[model samples]
Target: MLKENLVNILRTLQRERVFLLGSFVTLLIILGGLGFSFTEASEGGSFLKRFGEGLWWAVVTVTTVGYGDVVPKTSEGRLVGVALMVGGLLSFSLVTATVASIFIERKFRRERGLETLKETHHILVLGWHHDGETLLDQLLRRLPHTARVVLINQLPPEKMEGIRAKYPGREPLFVWGDYSREEVLLRANVRQAYKAVILAGRNEGETAAEVDQRTLITTLTLKSLSPKIRILAELLRMENKPYLERAGADQVLIRGQYDSSIMAGALASPGLYKVVDALLNAEGFTVWAVDVPSEFQGSPVKTFSDYLKNQHQALLIAIFSEGRALSLEDLLGDEPSSIDEFIRSKFVETGMTHLFGRAKMKFQINPADHQVLGPHDKAVVIAAQPPNL
Candidate 1:
């Protein structure tokens, strides 16, 4: 019974207008008593009569229904009654306005599932968790400052607000919904996004099967909607990597596999880890992709190196043929019918890695090994260091 009463009290408190009404009524009664007492002391009226008049005055002041039936003759009594009346009205209005707003917002959200987006070429982040937040911070740091990132998560407003307060600056537009649903992705404007990052949901006690199921659903939905959008997903399990890739994700970062691969490479050579870390971090030995023009069809790789030193102030790294192959052959001597063919032949001759679905230039490989020049080939060069480091 006691718990029930407490719950009732909390419910009543939530209906703030009722509290406001009761407060106004109580204030009126108090004001009336004070007014009657003051009038009695001044006019020498009977105690009962003074009390009655004071009650009347208090009621009128509190309700703002001043009937002028009983008046405050003393300056002190009048001032007190006036203060109480103003306080009562202000308090009542504030409470009523707050209650009304709560109802209105709830109704609005019920009618509309989520908000819309306007910016183009922006990134869309699905789900909100520790991993999501980390990815958001990294993207904000890496991408151009003007780029917009929209967050779609299933968390409530209070929870989302708490997460948002930690990040001060232009916050990403947030869409709260179950990310597995196609409607939620559509609401987030996934179709127009430049990239989509699907993060793993935190399911501490849940079975791995359930978690993988959820991740696969989200990935499939995103691909179905915008097949062209570059989807970078994080797959927790190694077995799920193929599913994510088949779902059309441009890149899948398998946490375990990636770490293991790096570790394995590092075990072979300690410097390998440092180089890989620097390259991935876009720091120290950075890699940039520089384009090769059509006019330089027959220009040797050496000429490009000279140009980088003098013009772009960058070192000429390995060039990716139009077919994305790194080669160790002479590019100028091998005259091909088309630039694309030339790059293809050169890339095959030299062993290089090409990241999928992205244009590239020469980067951290042996440029001396591949000396081919193609209109579409590029050079990825490292630039300067971070500021204030």
Candidate 2:
């Protein structure tokens, strides 16, 4: 504790050295002015009156206010005034220097992403991409207005003027740096974050592969720092999905694949895009993950489906479990099962089974009645509005 206190004191001194110097000089000036006041008390200056007046004069002198309410009547007092004037100049110089340094330091943090945030339960958005503005808008609309956020990306400081302007008072802290670096992640406080969304910053580098590669590196670094943090990452290459999964990313979006699939769907089924757009809209009827009834546990999938339709007045579309969507892959005991196993084992090991219990996500359009409902099974229902998360 003593060593920690010493380190803290040193840090404070380092940070406030200029202010401290100004204060020291101001104190000296006050003392000297008072000494001169005492020396010249018999020469038309009152010792008690002049000393009190001298202190106020010294302050006004430092501030360059020059109210002139009090004046030194003796030569000695005039000499003290000269000393005070010099000190005043130095003090004001220090004040200007401090303000300029503070502005420069803030600019440096904005440019280099050097802020070490220590907030808890914050949602971190890493890697600003081509779609970043759109993402930001949607996120702002969907998330609670009060949710704290940190955005770490490689965008230059000047390029972020739009974001600052748009947010006005509630701008998510912008950490302009390489997200793949541990120090940059530290700036965003990955360990304390509730979740993270990693965008594929195509503009930061050359090819799609390059973007995905950087994203993969960032995912690995984040997982290494905080294994429990839920990370959603975008990958341009489908092949990079495995790396993200291995790196413990909870959700991975293959950008090219989704765009291609959606385009194909649009081509095959005209107006399908409109329906999807409506479903994904932040403020509209959208697919939401909701808790299954406690009574539905161990019941067949059909039972929960009926309950959701009857009770919530919603369509039970799918169940999302583990990390990604529950699918035919899970029924086949393939990818989803492996991930589920990993999640189960990890949750049990860390006594975080409650989180898993709350995150039960399984899926079926019209599942067989024989298939039982599992604990932590959340129902993805198409509802009129999103629930409070």
- The CA lDDT of each predicted structure is 0.65, 0.70
Candidate 1, residues 47-118, lDDT tens digits: the string is 777887788777667667889877777887777777768876876677677767765865455334365544
Residue 202's lDDT within candidate 2 is 76
Worst 10 residues of 1 by lDDT: 325-334
What lDDT score goes with residue 49 in model 2?
72
> TM per model?
0.53, 0.71
Candidate 2 segments exceeding 4 Å error: 1-16, 43-70, 203-210, 259-264, 281-283, 291-316, 321-361, 366-375
Q: Give candidate 1 regions above 4 Å deviation.
A: 1-114, 155-170, 265-272, 282-285, 288-300, 309-370, 373-378, 385-389
lDDT of 2: 0.70
Q: Candidate 1, 114: how far from true, in Å?
A: 4.3
